[model samples]
Target: MENENLLKQISFIKEIDKIKYIQRRTKLFNSDRNENDAEHSWHLAMMAIVLAEHANEPVDVLKVLKMVLIHDIVEIDAGDTFIYDTAKDHSNTDEELIAAKRIFGMLPKEQAEEFIAIWEEFEEGKTNEAKFARSMDRFEPLLQNTSNKGGTWAELNVDYQRVYDKKKVINEGSTSIWNYSENLLNECVDKGILKK
Candidate 1:
């Protein structure tokens, strides 16, 4: 029955303990250390809360948190993609769409749809909520790189321009936050925290 399938899905949580999960081969932050998707999602949700004031327009932080927490569940099915991989030509959106149907479809009807909608909103990045949520999403890794001595950047041979290219999403959704981020990155550059 449809109801039966939904119930089963709700109870099935993908395991996040596997070391291979969310192990982005980044040269921007720490060396030989990889971040898990669950941790990244949780951290981004928290960053959304702490940095809500920097949004270009006021937004519902709770909604953003929900979006962040659930956004990458599909990654469990489709796998995480590295940011700088030239071969990763297909957008994560395509993979996640299939993943969403399978993952959220497991939950009960109403809840599944609600969660799927949130995930889709995040993928589209069209709404104020999605935009606000995404700014936090993009900012966290930059912070990780700068605070951790830009080990990731150093390994990747990253330049300031590459950093800006990767972080443009922050500016698109929230100029205030973007300004703050720019200032931070600039400081990091000045202090030799991020490679120029």
Candidate 2:
């Protein structure tokens, strides 16, 4: 049973490597190459750890890290939904839930349950850790876009109202970070990188 569990765990790890190929709409800072799900997840995990102190309410950094790292594994099968893509419909959560079950189920039962629970917690955005994790997920792409001189926002002509609508959740996690982001957004408009 131990060996069986080990094999399942190994298989799950191998399967998640596919996340590296799941490209997102955001580009790397000063680079043309689009970021992938794996890169995004890793970035958010690091942000969760580094920015935990800024969270409005205390959070379990480890839980936030776990939430960010595992939240997008579903994207491996469900495909990435661009936040600003008005043309393409947002990802169907039903499909993503199925993908999560199939992918995380590759692990042993207890481990699979824990991963799914973390993913759901992040999705629900109810707990302090989940809220903070969600903030990191949203904030990272904003930074990427700002760094790339409006990156996808410019290419798509995304406006201030739309950007604000997408990012308001950042305030739930860290008011300091949210304030910084708001300033950056205003700067983007002033610089003509994002539309007013």
Candidate 3:
């Protein structure tokens, strides 16, 4: 049974490597290249570690890290959806849930359940860890867009209000981070990088 579990774990590890190929709409900081799911997850994990102190409520940092890292693994199957995508509903939960089961299901049954639960928690965004994980998710793109002089905002012609509304999720986790992000958004509008 232990050997079978080890094999299942290794298979799951190999399967998740496909996340590196799932390209996101967001560009890298000060670069034209698009970011991939794996990079985004890693960045969010780092953000969880670096910004845990700023969370509005105390969060289990490790759980936050897990949430960030596993949050997008479903993208390996459902594909990356742009947060500001108007044509398609942003909450592609049904498709993502299917993908989540298939991808995380590669693990041992117990491990798969844990991952699915964590993923659901992140999706629900009701707990402190989920809120903070979600904040990091929204915050990273804001920094990237700002660094690239309004990376996707300019390229995609995303409106300032839309960006503001979407990024407001940051406030749920960290008031300080949200305050800074709001200021940055205002600056982008003033600079004509984001349309007012």
Candidate 4:
């Protein structure tokens, strides 16, 4: 059973490599290349570690890292969802849950349960860790948009109010980050990169 579990774990690790192929709408900092789920996850983990000091409430850095790492693994199956695609119906919740089970289930039962619990906690976004993790999710793309001279927002014609609505979750995690994001948004508007 132990060897079988090891094999299962190996298979799961290999399976998640598909995440690298799942390209996001966000661009890399100072680059035109689109970012992938793997890079996004890694960036979020780093952000959790570096920005934990800015969180409004105390957070478990490891827990935040874990949440960001696995949060998008489901996208390997459900595909990447663009944040500003308001016309796209918000209907992927069920699909993502199914994907989460199939992907995380590749591990031993106990390990799968733990991963699923963390993923679910992220989806719920209520705990301090989850809130902070979600903040990173929103904040990273904002940085990407700012860095790339208005990235997806400019390309998609997303307006300032919509951007604010989408990113207000940052306030729940870190007041400092939210303030910084607000200033960035204003700069984007002034630069005429983001729609006003």
Q: Among these predicted structures, which one has the highest TM-score? A: 3
lDDT of 4: 0.91
Model 3 misplaced stretches (Cα beyond 4 Å)? none
Clashing pairs in 1: 9-106, 27-152, 27-153, 28-152, 28-153, 29-152
lDDT of 4 at 44: 96
lDDT of all predictions: 0.76, 0.90, 0.91, 0.91
* Count of clashing pairs, candidate 3: 0
lDDT of candidate 2 over 54-139, digit per residue (tens): 99999989889899889889988888988887776663489889998999999999999999898989898889998899899889
Taking the tens digit of each residue's C-alpha lDDT, what string does model 3 give over 83-110?
A: 8777777654699999999999999999
Q: In angstroms, how far off is 141's CA in candidate 2? A: 1.1
Tell me how far the alpha carbon of residue 1 in candidate 4 is from the true structure, in angstroms, after superposition.
Answer: 3.1
Per-residue error (Å), model 3, residue 144: 0.2
TM-score of each: 0.83, 0.96, 0.97, 0.96
User: Backbone clash tally for model 2?
Assistant: 0
Candidate 1 regions off by >4 Å? 1-6, 14-20, 26-32, 193-195
- Model 4 lDDT tens row, 1-196: 9999999999999999999999998899989999999999999999999999999999988889899998999998899878777666443488898998999999999999999999999888899999999999999999988999888887888899999999999999999999999999998989989887
